[model samples]
Target: MLTPWRLFLCQMALNIFYHIAKEIGEMESKWRLLHKANIKLCSQLIFTFITWQMSGYLTTKNSSLCLGGQDIFATVRENSPTGEIIAHLSINGDPGASSIRLCLTGENADWFYLEGRTIRLNSSFSRTLDREVLGSVLIAALTCYEDDIIRSRYRIMVEILNENDNMPYYLEDTIQPRYISELLTVNSMVFTVKARDGDGDTITYMTDKSTADASYFRIDLPNSGMVILDKPLDYETKTQLQVVIFAVETTTKEKYSTTATVTVNVLDGDDQYPQFQPCAPVYEDGDHNICTNPVYSVNITETDEDAVLYFSPGPIHAEDGDKDILTPLVYSILSGDGNGRFTIDSKTGEISLRQRVENRLLTPSFRLRIMAAQVNDPKKYSVATALVHVVSENRFPPFFNKTVYKGFLIESSSPATLVTTYGNQVLVVQAIDRDFRDGINPKIHYTMQPLTGSNKLYHISQDGIVIAKTDRLRAFDRHILEVIATDEESGETAHASVDIEVLQRGQPVPRSPFGEERLFGDMNAGMAGGIAALVLLVAVTVLFLFLWLAKRRRERRDPADRGAVALGKHPNVEASSPIAPRHVL
Candidate 1:
């Protein structure tokens, strides 16, 4: 029905309308700029009004080209060539010879390129994704353009596939030395092994065959980085150990591993008690061990309070069973010598007196118990005993037991009445020398001093015996005698007084009074004095009462007589009104 020229015009008008509609769509969406040719064609078609109405009818039948903005996923081997094609993109609507162009946009555009409908790589990728540089996901937009006009956009994603290229290595280039106690229990975690894989693969840890005794150590696998001890360690045998560890990738096709050398130093622990050397012989007391010998004897010839008396109980030697080098043995006193008179050196275990032994009479000897223990473990110890003997020189005088003595005699008795005897005999003058243990003064002699009253009244013999000089007739006479005991060796003298009571013959001999009866007599005397005071008080009271009764009777009679006289003088005056003073009665 239409002519050739008209049909040609109609097709050109429809094409212009469709292009103008696309340009308007692109302007509304505000996508990336299209090519320079598409922009010039859209500007020229915009001036034709009839073409604008025809474009609506023609474009209504032809759907607009769209990319749907759907995401695409592709994976390629690592280190692939740049510009490698991954996948071809398809448009959803018809675009007829409009010069469709494709381009990448956004931050990932530098790494990717779009050629026609194909997505290609712009740069090579590493299998190990460096999130710090390229990030985890590559985000890019592929823009579709027709005749220099943008129609739609789509998102493209490309992931780099991993390759086994790098071996595992320790996380730290150089491992720090580790220290473990010798007393550490078996199967205890000593340290952790940290490693990393360049390919981001799971790493498994294992002890290398070159390690020192693999039976003593074990490694936990991928999940745990712990290295455990399989056997106990001793510092005495081996102080240090070297361990070789290997970290391998779990999923790598070719076994790729890295080695790390760790120096493990074994530390000392408080595992052994101190031991003493054979300085003295040890004696046992019912399962208890005691050290003897090294008998130290000192004669206390002089007295010095502040001087130090040094005596070596010999050097103390001890050794630890664990052979720990860091800790040493220390010595101390455990018991005996509670006064702290003896002290031992902590390092050498040598014993000495802190103060001088001034008097052997007081403390004759000292018994001390010394203990040696490890400084690290004080509770683990060993004990030994030391006996110290003291000898004393004669430096004191003889002392008498009693300062005075009493004796009785008859005035008219015969001569040699056997008054008293001394020197280890009956009624003797006892003297003791403190420097001797026997307490008896063997070199002591007794003599009597002259009496003042009668010169020859009494005499003392060499053996300490007092005898009457003559028969006397004096009643109630007392004689005093001084008996002196002298030490022949040291010339030290001790004296005692003897009081001799002379009683008349046939006079009742007085007996020594009992102590309890004397106390009872004193009580009776106090009670009698109290009774006499009470009797005197009662007698005084009775006399006062008798005088008072007599005075009252006289007062009564005087009043009756006055009444008779007053009645005769004036009847108004009453005579019975006058009374005696109360104090008089």
Candidate 2:
């Protein structure tokens, strides 16, 4: 015999089967019906079936069987084994019901099974789901049955909460190489890092503190995996940097992380000026100022016929302080090169003469001012000077200013007499070297050759000055003196004959047209006396003028009382002037 509760559940089960068959038939004919009508009917049937199933399980009038009304949640580990109980389901009014059975049905019913009141995994369950089948939230219908009949139907939601089983790893195993200029501003974007977690957990990016200093960089978390430069970089100090980046799960208690190496190559920039190597210590001038730049000396002789005259004076070198190593430098002649005789390599600091020096006798020495600058920035530079000394081979002899020089002296003139003043330079003979572009030659010296005379009458000074040795000669007498100009280095010589004419005391000298002899003693005495008399006259005139001006000022103050005279008068005299006149007389 079937009980009333049993019979009611049996009827509900038949109703459920009928509704499910009808839904299938409607689905096949769904295209034929109006879209709205079909949807409305399907919804009504679903709601009625759920209501009927709930009402069958409630035995008492006050008992309620909530279908999708009461919230149900279950947490399951990802990839759980089949038949693993996730959570137990309970009907509100059921306690110790021997005939009650739990059945799972819905879109994801295939993934779970029901055992009495417990919900267990029927198949291997993965947290990762396809939206077409089952979304992130697993919804199923948990139905209580009695004797193979539906009693109550409840909608349950199984949320597969993620666990830290899967570690976070970088999307790319290695980061792409990034190039950043040393001059890049701080807080600039360097590169981005991307990471993924199979468990769908929030991932945080960070730099490995042990690998490199994290102070110079910062990482954006969660969605954005961008890395930025927190501080400036210098290529000179460090050329390349490797930063280890870690991607970690934010919710994991353990330190589960994935690492990737980011190679940051610092590029060179034009930030530093060129610095020249310090030359030899240079002495300061008298005024404590650097009179000369760094000097490099090179000796070139006439016999030296090398094809390339390398300027090895001091190997010019310049370095860019901003670069990790010395960069390319350019060399140029800044000044002191009047002629285009030398050229230097722009990349290398090697300097060479463009043309060979045919004659070193003329130009014994010269100087050149050279500049070294970085190739990147030419304006940033340093300057140095080089002195080139030449050794002559005496290809040409010295030449005199004049072939014949005429001189005059007074007859019986005293030794070292004022024949010619060094300041005036009357009897000067200049010798020049044709080998040099500049006519003046410092090597050639002047001297008087041996003359046919008992005593050396006259001699030529090194500076080409003719001086008389003694005061012994006759009037109208003449002497011919030969001045030999010799080159100290080349041993070459040239001579010029100087003709000297003697004159009497009154006769005019040949070269001294202004009459060089003068009585300086008398002239000086006259000049002194004239100056003293003029000073005395000026003093007397000033004193007389001062006295006359004083007398005129006194007269202007007392004009009317100039000639009046006062006489003493007796006190008792009655007449006005009889006693006064006697006293006055």
Candidate 3:
């Protein structure tokens, strides 16, 4: 502290100089020449003012008059009320109150005034004490004096204490939308934001959790002003993120805070390879997803050549997985076509055969590796399999042995009872395809073609077995079922009829209208002599009976011939003998 007694002296001396300068106007005024002789008086007054000094430094010469102390200090916050006392003026000598006076003066004197012994801010001044403009400390002088002579003087320092008056603010451009790539490395700095405190307080940064996208980012440090990515980014899920940042000051008595909203735009990165359409996802982890290309298949006959092949699932297609930018893709066959037997269109993934299949019996199926790659970048590509099955040409159409077949089933029997023919024999319907040995073709299929709507009472198996649902079949119910025989590869069909009669429970199945003959060709060479051998046996039995009859007739005719000879004398006897002989033969 600077003692007010000494500070007052310096302040008083400074005030005298200030008042003298204000009252003395310009010495060389226009009218001053009219009283040129008075210049001497003005010079004397100037001399007296120049020689004026306080007893402040009289200690070297032992002059007794002096102030108590020249070291005085005080503090007042910025924007302090006018008339707020900053320092008290004091004097050491025992001068009467009526003889001594005090005042504030110096370079910054106008900012304050004196009320007897106290120095305070002057509210009448147009400017106020703003810490932003006045800096840390304000300086002035205080002086005290006797009626005519300077007594003591001292310098006064009033520290301008800082106040939390300004709010923090962010630069206009720094908080605008920023573009970030989804392919950015983890734990890397995304962008930076900084806030300024006008009051010059140390500022720290923090993200507000109340915002929805706060979890995706974090502050690098309390005071770093650097925003970092807290987790990986996904463009597909979130294209933009908003973060609310708060810049605050806690060093002052009251907290000061400011907020800025930052938008981070996620840009699409060409980080994914081309993927085939109809994606089959196999694994998923948040935005990281994986899938496999499906294997496409199609069957063609060995005779087909130079034709565009169509696939089962769909035509071969692929696209860039980055949806925002659908980059064009090119297609080609990578392998399994070394002989150039197949060619593919690059833009449109179409496969065409070059020539006929020489030998499908040796190589039935071909697996070609098809690659789809981005046109701009060849390294980014995906490979899939195209399966082509070459089959033999179909020749013969299937046919049924009988146009219509009759079979009977007893009602009230267990479910899935088989129909029976004459003599309780199980009836079987068969179709013949001469292309195969034994007139049997595995490729041939059978189905019951409904003659009427809703045929739920019975069902047919793939192998042409007609089973009757006994529980559903009422007693004495008759059903006529139309069956179809199809040659699957040849696409030819043959139709036949199956007349099934549902007999009452405990009733026998009547004989077939076609007699004991077998309906199908399967009955050949079974438990019977062949037709040719039976004919030979019948002929031999007839010849033996004829020979025995001839022998009996000759024996009876010999007795008859002798009786006729004895009656040879009559003519009627001779004629009767010829007739008798003929009858006997």
The best candidate in terms of lDDT:
3
For residue 130, model 1's alpha carbon misses the true position, in angstroms, by 6.5
Error of 3 at 227 (Å): 2.8
Candidate 1 deviant stretches above 4 angstroms:
1-72, 89-100, 115-117, 124-136, 173-175, 220-222, 275-314, 319-347, 351-371, 374-378, 383-585
lDDT of 2 by residue, 1-585 (tens): 334555455456545655676778855344334333444445555556756867875643254432222446876655556887867665653434655556678887777875655668766445433332343567788776665666567777777655556678776643887888999998788888888876677788878767654666887544587888887887766778888888888776875788888889999877766655543435655422222334666666756543344444346566676645566788888875547766667777666665667777777776887787876667777788777667755567788878877676665556675344222347777798888778667878888864545257676777777777546666666677788988765657888887766655654443344645432332455687798899999999999999999998877864333423122334343445456655756
TM agreement with the true structure for every prediction = 0.42, 0.42, 0.49
lDDT of 1 by residue, 1-585 (tens): 334555456456556655776877855233234322354354444435446778885784365565444667877666567877877766764333455666679877787765666677776445333443453467777777766677777777777676676777786734578988998899899889788877788888888766556667887554577888988887756788888887877776887888888888999877755555553547755433454334432323324343334444334455665555636778787776648776777887666565667666787666767677777678887776566656544578887777777666655646566563222123455577787788776667887875557567777766566777547536667777788888754456888888766655553333442321222222456687798899999999999999999998977776646765644655455446556545324
Q: Candidate 3's residue-wise lDDT over 204-284, tens digit each?
A: 899998888888999879888889899888787789999999988868766788889999999988877888877878999
Question: Total backbone clashes of model 3?
Answer: 20
Between 1 and 3, whose lDDT is larger? 3
Error of 2 at 93 (Å): 14
lDDT of 1 at 563: 63
| Model 2 segments more than 4 A misplaced | 1-82, 86-104, 123-136, 142-154, 194-205, 212-231, 248-252, 272-297, 302-307, 313-331, 338-364, 372-377, 392-585
